[model samples]
Target: MANLAKIVYRPVGLVGGVVAGIVAGAIFKRVWKIVDREHDAPDALQAEYSWPKMLLAATLQGAIFAAVKAAIDRGGAKGFERATGEWPGS
Candidate 1:
């Protein structure tokens, strides 16, 4: 049962990861637009942005990505458990 759960979870996890990334990107874009109306948040390699601004964008993006990933992973695990009658992890 656990093996089957693991097998089924692979594709579900992949799809969930892709979806989570898209959702996180959209969320971060909207948030950046709202917080910094004059310009888009700078990428790490861009030197035009100050340390504080760049750090803020990095922190916000990380938080959003983590939250979305956690949500998607948990949801996928729950669905897998429901379908297989076995938890995917020990």
Candidate 2:
């Protein structure tokens, strides 16, 4: 635990998490938007891109989830621990 603690405050995890979140949010947003559009739902996605808010929300949430998941999944891989490297846990 101590050995891996070095990266606890590192920007790598935060940046990575934000990136992942943004990607996931964007994908989900697109899917929902298309579905809503098909049914002519008033809750359809924005016609114009709201990069500022959308990206910020996505990145922020994504980063948090990514970081937590990473931390929990720490410790080398389950099976074949010695064979493959450990998962990125935080």
Candidate 3:
């Protein structure tokens, strides 16, 4: 249903995208560290302890989450149509 699709599905997609993106970004970061040089593991604050990067990730993820949440909060596709006078599907 359009209602369900817009409300539950779309927001989930948006949130999911944000989550996936953040996760990918985290993977791309050098936030982890190795406890010992001989080991390939990370140290307490060596590998992934960047405050700036963490803040950036949080902001980015929060923004994306907010965007989708706002859309769903406003109302689903029907509400969108009411305001815009345009339905996506015929």
Clashes of each: 0, 3, 10
- Index of the highest-TM-score prediction: 1
- Report the C-alpha lDDT of model 1 over 16-90, residue by residue, as the tens digit: 999999999999999999999999988989999999999999999999999999999999889878877788764
**Candidate 3 C-alpha error for residue 20, in Å:** 13
By lDDT rank, best first, the candidates go 1, 3, 2
Expressed as tens digits, the lDDT of each residue in 22-50 for candidate 2 is 66556556654564454221222665545
TM match of model 2 to true structure: 0.36
Q: lDDT per residue, candidate 3, 24-69, as tens digits?
A: 4454343222222332333236655466645554565566556654
lDDT winner between candidates 2 and 3: 3
Q: Considering every candidate listed, which one attains the maximal lDDT?
A: 1
RMSD of each: 1.2, 8.3, 9.3
Show the colliding residue pairs in model 1. Answer: none
Candidate 2 segments whose C-alpha is farther than 4 A from its true place: 4-9, 38-90
